[model samples]
Target: MSCAIKTKNDHIHTPRDFRGGRHVFVNGNEIRYVIYADTKKGIVKYHPHPVRLKKGSDVVYTRTLKGLVTVEFIK
Candidate 1:
């Protein structure tokens, strides 16, 4: 899938624990971000250093990680 960031900046900053994934590119560089969600019981969950996602968009996290990290989503 392909996406774009609505920005004019030269550099984008993401969380430190992010991992690389299948990417959509703009001008040959990659876009990165993380996702956060809540379960049915109102339990908060986080995805650390997520990539290939768009801000303000909700996508099912398709990758796996070891250990615990607080993955937060930004719009």
Candidate 2:
């Protein structure tokens, strides 16, 4: 599958904004997922799965170290 991935130019200062929802590209298709932030632990969690693209109908992500990262999705 052919997927388009675009990352936001602006930086995400507040993790709360992710709570609203965000989109990501998975195998040339766009998929929406919810985000959760743990302020106390300084960790951000993406619901439904993490931000790794998989080659199937199911959306899955592998856990990784916490840090500043970019999320690219098809628009």
Candidate 3:
């Protein structure tokens, strides 16, 4: 399987992205599913939503290099 992520393929992602030995096929593609394995397993559907601030909401925004932005908040 192919992936379009900036992180390395060997990077470990916890929980949902686990490392195991499993095989799945989709659209004539041979996917090698493994625990935290770097493959197309990261592919997921996207939900379109707008970012909005509500009343009594607390958030902090940080600007990083290359104009990247990070938002930190607590529930």
Model number with the top TM-score: 2
Worst 10 residues of 1 by lDDT: 36-45
Cα lDDT tens digits, model 2, 1-75, are 645344462334233553234443333444344344332333444544435656885666634225434444223
How much lDDT does each candidate structure score? 0.33, 0.41, 0.31
> Arrange candidates by TM-score, highest first: which order?
2, 3, 1
Query: 1-75, model 3: which lDDT tens digit per residue?
Result: 665345564433323643433343224343332122222343312111332344567532221121111221122
TM-score of each: 0.17, 0.26, 0.17
Which ten contiguous residues of candidate 3 have the minimum total lDDT? 63-72
For candidate 3, the TM-score is 0.17
Clashes of each: 2, 2, 6
Stretches of candidate 3 off by over 4 Å are: 1-19, 33-75
* Candidate 1, residue 19: how far the Cα is off, in Å: 23
Stretches of candidate 2 off by over 4 Å are 1-34, 47-53, 60-75
Q: Which pairs of residues collide in model 1?
A: 18-49, 47-71
Local accuracy of candidate 1 as per-residue lDDT tens digits, 15-50: 342433323222333333323222222222234364
- Considering summed lDDT, which 10 consecutive residues are worst modelled in model 2? 34-43
Angstrom error of the Cα, residue 65, model 2: value is 6.5
